[model samples]
Target: MSIQKEDIDHLLNLDKIKADEKNAHIVIDPDQCAACQAKPCLIVCPALLYTLDETGALNFDYAGCLECGTCRTICPHLKKWEYPRHTFGIYYRQG
Candidate 1:
């Protein structure tokens, strides 16, 4: 069985998790990212942050993140993925 958008949306609706939206701890260098053909971050991100515009520019919103390092793990262009320095950045409700 497949988990539909509504299923994921329902899960998100149930989340009592808090996030620090001001500071986007995970930073991506656009220059380094430009060369990448396969952008796994857009697909792997649970929060639906990484996106592409009509002009093909990378649009990322690191708000309400799970901080699971899914983006970091998937990006081949990444030399080193940096997690949030602050401890209170991501608060997981269920997990």
Candidate 2:
């Protein structure tokens, strides 16, 4: 899949707005993430939403998330971690 420059810019702008909105956010369980030695969420996130901190814990940015389910699939250590609420994640203009 290829994205045009304009589309990329738009997505970036949207992400900024999404992040700024406090109501819509990524909810993560640090305890659930802490024991994850594999840290698959760090690599599987297409938008790099799942980032690591100085302590090696997962930090997430819901706005930049594409909601592709990659993190959900790659994470073998956790049972469930909630993402942005419905209708609060990325929205592509085109399929």
Worst 10 residues of 2 by lDDT: 11-20
Clashes per prediction? Answer: 0, 0
Question: What RMSD does each model have against the real structure?
Answer: 3.1, 5.3
For every model shown, what is its TM-score relative to the native structure?
0.70, 0.59
Q: What does candidate 2's lDDT look like per residue over 52-79, in tens digits?
A: 7897767876667666777767665444
Error of 1 at 44 (Å): 1.2
In candidate 1, stretches whose alpha carbon ends up further than 4 angstroms from where it belongs are 1-9, 16-18, 78-80, 85-87
lDDT of 1 by residue, 1-95 (tens): 86555776677775554455655577777887777778887778877777789988787766656678888878766545566666555554664
What is the alpha-carbon RMSD of candidate 2 to the true structure? 5.3
lDDT of 2: 0.63
Clashing pairs in 2: none
Off by over 4 Å in 2: 1-26, 76-87
The candidate that wins on TM-score is 1
